[model samples]
Target: MSYNLHQLHAFTTIVSSGSLGRAAALLNVTQPALSRTIKRLEEDVGASLFERHVKGMQLTDIGAALLPHAQLLLREAENAREEIDAMRGLAKGTIKVGAVGSLAAHFLPLAIDRVLGKWGNLHVEIIEGVWDRLAEGLINYEIDLALSTATNDSDGIVAVPDCRWEDNSFVVAAFGHPLRKKPKLTLADTLTARWAIPPKGTAPYEHMRETFLSRNLDMPDIAVQTRSVTVLKSLVAECSFLSWMPEPMYDSESKAGIMGTLPIPGISAARTLTAFRRRDGILPRPAARLLDELRSLTERGMAMQTTR
Candidate 1:
């Protein structure tokens, strides 16, 4: 059975507001009317979406499953309206993007600046996370695009082959750290060094692990493991802890002479970065515009590299 936007809106609003009275006030409708909307939607779905309780409405298993689809439908409807408005010469829209910390640090800001310069009315929303979180954002329609390291396993997302580039990862330390003064460095030299890195099973962690394992060396015992970029940087700069990171993530620090990659022999690795989107549907115009800027940026970067 088909459900209308009104019913879905009422359902989602109630989910957000947590109670019928609050949802009714937010929707500017009587509580009875709001209740009728959910009743009709429940009838169409043939499932009890929410369990009534003294505290608030809680989603049943069926409602939990339906929430993502409902949100996706609402987002697409908004995109359609924006697309038509854009066609009518209204250059206003929002671009939602998710990216890993590395790309978010340098690459994405450049593209976003270019896009906003062309369309001043456009808005951008960005969230930083690892690949798993970015993939979830894409699949749930929370983000129109994802910037992350290239991966072979894409369950519900497709990579944009033209929007890919390479960046190098390196073992880094604070500029004045003792390790920086070492005459010569090797992976084995860092085996006993205090380290701060992303948690195990994350892409950064796995890459760091492989860097050691590939050299027939056991992984170093990490002194601190975290996902927060700020915390990682603080530990590295102020605490003299070493960490593995992509160059872009530490570009500003390196430029400021606060931190620099340790000159370890044969320790750097190049990783391919890619842009991705959902497997289905045309990308919204705003997101597409940002993607174009990203492609241009990548091409310009590659050209500069070739010239060098």
Candidate 2:
């Protein structure tokens, strides 16, 4: 049976608010008007939606059965309206964005600022997570877009080629670390030293493993396994622990003499930092604009800082 959106909206509002008076107040309609709307809806459906009571209104069996369907219809209608608005470039919906820590910390702010300045109705939420979590979110449609260390496409997702940044992150330590002063630091020189590494499944860990194996060396023991950049940076600066990180992660600190890359050859490797989205998902106009801004920002030169 065909149903009007207004009837479904009123029905859902009444169910949510649990009383005619409250629903009227919530919908900003007079009680008689709301009652008539509900009555007309009941006529259309040929079922008593609510069993009126002295204390409050309770949904009848039919109302209980139809409540979920009505809510779904209302949600779909709202989504359709938002999509139309987005197509018109009238920014008025929440855009969910996922990103790794470095992108969230350094690049996201600028991109967000650019979008927020022009569109007052736009809202963006930053979900800071690793590639595994964010990638899963993108595939499952929970995230609208993701900035990741992955350049390649996975199942049900694609990366924007223009938004990708090639990076060569390096093994680093504080300037005061003995390895930094080594006249000729070799692969064996770092094997026994304490290391701070990311969780086992991350890019940094894989890069470290590949760096050692390419040179015919085994992976070394890690002193700490952490996901917090703050903790990793602190350990590398205050202790003798060597850690691998992208240049942007330590640039300002490096200039302050708190961090520096170890000049070990063959240890640095190239990886792409990319912005990704689901292949089947279409972004709202505001989010699409922000995605374009992200591409522009990265393309203009997201350069790694030189070690001080």
Candidate 3:
């Protein structure tokens, strides 16, 4: 049975967006048209690709198996177009970058600015989420490159050289939080305090949990669990709630006296942030340049921390 590239792409987009309407919107097509494409593709495959419900679409086992292959095909097709464009000496193309929250806010703009300065015609789409989700986007080709605190290998993805970092020492507590005024701080002192933390199973969550466990203490009270660093930071700043985050995450606020790092020593550890991409493909010049800028930023951050 033969499959159409457009149909496969529609299927992939639907899987990514989780709803027919959203997928159609992303593809700039009508919902009816997207539905027809999926139907035809399902007929060609002889199996239902999704489980449809009133709320959203869920991929079937078959659909799950087909997704990676479809993504690879789509990526190759895109690469072909980009290569041809490059051959014509056009320095224009969109780069999709996935980054974690802090990097998105702190480093992504700087990197984007640098790349845009060199290639004024380039467009960058920034998608921010937890590291795991971003890594999945990189593997699926939904994002061309990812900046995240993850170094574990994903299939068909490679980490660029010297991109890993272990200097993200995070601390918990907010400015004027009573805990900060204590003569001495300990894990037990902060156990009863409400906390905001990353969602479960993420590196930050695991790191915070291990930090508590290593001290032979029970997990602290988790008052809020979310993936958005903006929300986490806001809560920590405006309320007495404690949250854990990298030192760089609050440099500006802390300097403004709007936030404070509690002297809770030994509660934080180094987190590795790495940039990754598909192992088999060559990045277009725009993506390559942005990546170089990100690397340079990481290097500068490390240097600044060393001198502190």
What would the per-residue lDDT of candidate 1 be over residues 99-209, giving only the tens digit for each residue?
888889888988998999998778999999888888888987889999998887565789998988887888999989887677877789898899999899888988888
TM-score of 1: 0.85
Count the clashes in each prediction. Answer: 0, 0, 0
Order of models, best TM-score first: 1, 3, 2
Stretches of candidate 3 off by over 4 Å are: 1-70, 86-91, 280-282, 297-308
Question: In candidate 2, where is summed lDDT lowest over 10 consecutive residues?
Answer: 299-308
Q: Is candidate 1 or candidate 3 better by lDDT?
A: 1
Query: Tens-digit lDDT track for model 3 on 114-133?
Result: 88887777788889898778
TM-score of 2: 0.67
- All candidates' lDDT scores? 0.87, 0.79, 0.79
In model 2, where do residues sit more than 4 Å from their true spots? 1-92, 139-142, 302-308
lDDT of 1 at 108: 90
Model 2 score (lDDT) = 0.79
Give the per-residue Cα lDDT of candidate 2 at 56: 73
